[model samples]
Target: MHSLRPLIALLSATAVAAPLRADAQTFEPLSTCVSSLRQELPAKVKPETFETFTRDAQDLRPVVDTATKTQPEFQLPIWDYIARRTDEQRVAQGRDIVKNEQAALASIQQRHGVDGATTVAVFGVETDYGRVRGAYPVIDATLSRACLNLQSAERKDHFFTALWLVQEGVVRVDEFKGSWAGAFGMTQFMPGTFAKYMSAADDKGRVDIIHSVPDALATTARYLRGLGWIEGVPWAVEVRVPPSVAQRWNATESEHGCLTQQSPVGKCRRVAEFAVDGVTRVDGQPLVRPNSLLGQQLEPSLNAALLMPAGAQGPAWLVTPNYQAIWRYNRADAYALAIGLLSDALRGSAPQRTPWPTDDAGLSRAEFRDLQAMLLRLGHCDVVVDGASGPKTSAAIRDEERKLGWVETGRGGQKVFIALKKSSAPEVACAAAVPASAPELAASAAASAASR
Candidate 1:
């Protein structure tokens, strides 16, 4: 089964995008899922809800399956991912949301200790501030995801819980619509998260994250707090890694003990630890100071993970625990960074200072699909032609690199595509089989033979 983190990211990106239409062969009935739910969730869900849910549930199995295979995190370059999510238009819209929703956002900040800008940023990224909430019926999407063999047991549990919410009258099945992966509401909460952290801002005895902006923002703030967002700490700060510093902490290393073992976002150490090793801010200033958020500064002892999204030569970041909280919302570094950067933009901070290292940028979705097709033709990969770069595609890239005696970074880029094309060129193949000097040598051999 694919990882749930990428699945969540995929769902978030495609929630507003059109869903794939499935033919009869691709579609599967929800009878198995209904049976399993009855067996597993009898105590938590009532029988009538199960009957109603099954009656209403449409098989979106094909859509969920395709979506899981083509997640944007695995397909897009980090720079592209961040750029699309935190574009100038998104930043402008986010600022407007911050202005218009000030009172409601301030109330959430006071109650949950999560900043309003950050909450608004989450709202913008999750569903474009409720403008592009998903179109799929949540009951069908959840049931579809729950029944799939590729889905994890934990995911199945969560889908069942969503049905239970419908059964218990927490949310109506008719009104429940969301992404193909079952995340709903303005801020895109999974059913399990909604069950735990759904909140109501006003005295009305309801917590509706689906339609109410204030309720959604408050719920989002509550969710972030539950994920361990510190009140006044910034999620991440731009930093500079000195050229003189040793290369042991480079992200490419497979063995770094605790640094490699962290979950979701992965890797963390105290800022002082990197300071001891010569890392500093872009202005060459020491990073021993406290983390600042809005106007408040946090103590310097907080642990932060160093990230180089584009490798050693590119931009660097010191991501705090609050960054991890953002990551918990969608477990991609690119997604978290987009949220942080967008929030900063909404608050009038400058854009990214450093550029990505490579001149070849990266492949687009179409380019990646072409790369996958080329890999398939070369017999290096055997996966579906989805744009996502899964383990099989990465290994295939490494295999091709090995054949060309190039460095085995396993990253798909324009260079890789060019190399594949050049290697497959007829002229290049002919030259490889017959050296450039072969014609001259043939003439010389003929002259020698005639003389003899």
Candidate 2:
């Protein structure tokens, strides 16, 4: 029983914490530590290909115990996990893959200044526009925790990132595979970030990201110009402020004496003393501003970080240093605000006409699976419907929106489909109440005790 499912599937990251430095001489114990570190790896990889890749990395440790028991046993309902990533059929197939890849996304934004709407919002938030690049087995999810030695230097840093994608032939050992955290193409990346920022020569000399749309939009603008991406700045925006401003904005920059209205003293008064086209003095009086848009007017000295990750009630932006270089591809804040709101909705920018605390009747996916089948007929939650509202269906829709007095709203909206359509009717209307019975043997014994 000591297997807390390999420490909750290696600390299921939601906010970049996967760093885990590990040492005590790379500790041992997971049964003679994966056969003494498979004798320090690399022998041009084969011994019946390391025993059929350790029997397919011991069959994906039961999909991290079936995505943590399918999220809570058929009681799932944050409007079925945000209606599977804001679906309107995945935003009308991400507006036809941004209009049939506009000349391969404007020659990958003129050779990697990185913007084609944040590379089609990182191809519409990692594999939706391409549609789910994850079934698993990128060398069985990087040798199943680098052979279950767990965080041993971040699973030998994703096991030498699947042996540097098979020594740069960019994946082929049964055509590799992806996600259960190995991440793959069409924006999921992660072969040590596609070998530190992949790019293919766009103005036309070829560079493909598994089948060129000008090499996956210039290998995601040469992996956000090797993670310092700043071309025209703004990978964060949605500002509208004015409730007399000061909404804390993640405090500590010496608690606001850095004049924090989220650093708007025209960007911390030329943050670190002047030069974007240099000239400062608003209340003091002088102006010039035009630093660099990167195209015909480029100028970067690099220094930015203002991230507003959906707090203080949602949109607000400033983040730069090419927005933490798109958090090295996929370290979420809703995966970098869905690739900075699909690069401002592929330059057209809608869906956020500032109405994300919904209720003017916006709750579909069959009303979020009829409010997760009325939160599994009312005993609260059971998990799967996959419309997605996550964090245990916003803690069972904020515990049934605090027992109906409502206000808890971690948002599934339409008041969680009118409180699960008033818990699927029959409360008094001249009938014997009924409706309950859908437990399916405690959701089939919690999905068969999570595939054990």
Candidate 3:
């Protein structure tokens, strides 16, 4: 037993050290992320090329840090985030960009099968139509993240891939400044993604994405093609599910891990059976079952996964394989959904036919303070409201959500905020209630409160 205890102690120490090792991932600074790689890189590059990468990486620090910390906390809700991109203003602007740049976008679509909407969405999202590619030094941020060697293996890969790009002379160090994530040019591709998908030649001889609009858009299309993007199928489609139905959905099974980034949803045992719209197709076709939906049909066969990010009462979607392709661009469902929805909006479609329950009322700062008071009174939270949601405020909001029959998204949303404003106790009150974390609701609640 004593021997077992020491073994257990050693195992615990290793467990603790593992996280420390992971957190050790830090910024390497552009110079080091590149120059250091010459020692291990394929020994074919000239010594002068290595020296050039070192110099370029050193100069890229300013650009990298600027991009990384520029928006440490993105506060836009899915609805608002999707809405802004798909709004009439943006759609009209996209149309103009497309009309003026048709020949270029069409040529790219022909070669890569990536449509203008996807191209535009990428351009709009990456740097707001390339108006702001970022003010950071790409080398510095890449090096910083690579050196920190923190909990990011993927980022480390990006660092070295950047070095490869320099050695290959695909892009000189001077012209390579971009986002901290190494997502550069109009389409925002990380160095590794760029290295993999960037074609050396467009219809024109230029392979450069930094200066050439045609090359960049085409390169983005190539990336989508490499990711198995379907040509004509929509990325995602707006769906209407009646209140009587409950739609249960899950992403395809993954041997690697869960389909989401926030937390793992566990292994997929079988395709989860979910509710569907009882109504049939526009042609008076019978409603297709979820199981049958997975199989191909005579019409355009689209393998889709239903997504309901804002709980059951919010907007719903049937995201197709192309949607997953967009998700491959960025793992966040919200981001992919935004891109997919924006694609639809750019094509001139209204919001989902299903009515979103958005009119539950807003939570003001004072009201939030009151909600915080109730939470602290119940001993679930020991922090002040201050009209801001730090960790404790979120904890309090989660406690409140569980009290009501609300869905427990840790981040604060309008529903949780409204529920907090009402201040009603479940049958058992706080003492008897089991407190659970609600990060999503508290996150949103903090935003709403702080704005006021």
Best by TM-score: 1
1 or 2, greater by TM-score: 1
Cα lDDT over the full model 3: 0.50
Of 1 and 3, the candidate ahead on TM-score is: 1
Tell me the tens digit of each residue's lDDT in model 3 across 1-452. 00000000101111110100122234445445455555654454466754655564444334333322212123334443444345555566666776777888877887788898787776655445665554334555565555544345566556667666777777777777665445566666667667667764344554787877667777777877776687876665455544444243433222112322222233211112222234232233333444456422212233345556665776666555676666666544545665676666665655456544565333434554555666666676454655434456656565666767665444444566565556655322343433423321222211110000
lDDT of each: 0.65, 0.47, 0.50
The alpha-carbon RMSD values of the candidates against the true structure, listed in the order shown, are 15.4, 20.3, 13.1
Model 1 stretches with alpha carbons more than 4 Å out: 1-3, 7-29, 149-153, 243-246, 250-267, 290-298, 360-452
Q: Which stretches of candidate 3 lie over 4 Å from their true place?
A: 1-38, 44-48, 55-75, 150-157, 242-247, 250-301, 360-452
What does candidate 1's lDDT look like per residue over 274-321, in tens digits? 788887766677776544523323345566677675667788877677
In order of listing, the candidates' clash counts read 0, 19, 34
Off by over 4 Å in 2: 1-33, 36-42, 45-82, 86-93, 105-122, 125-143, 146-161, 165-180, 184-186, 189-214, 217-388, 396-398, 405-452
Q: Between candidates 2 and 3, which one is better according to TM-score?
A: 3
In angstroms, the error of model 3 at 139 is 2.3
* lDDT ranking of the models: 1, 3, 2
TM-score of each: 0.71, 0.31, 0.60
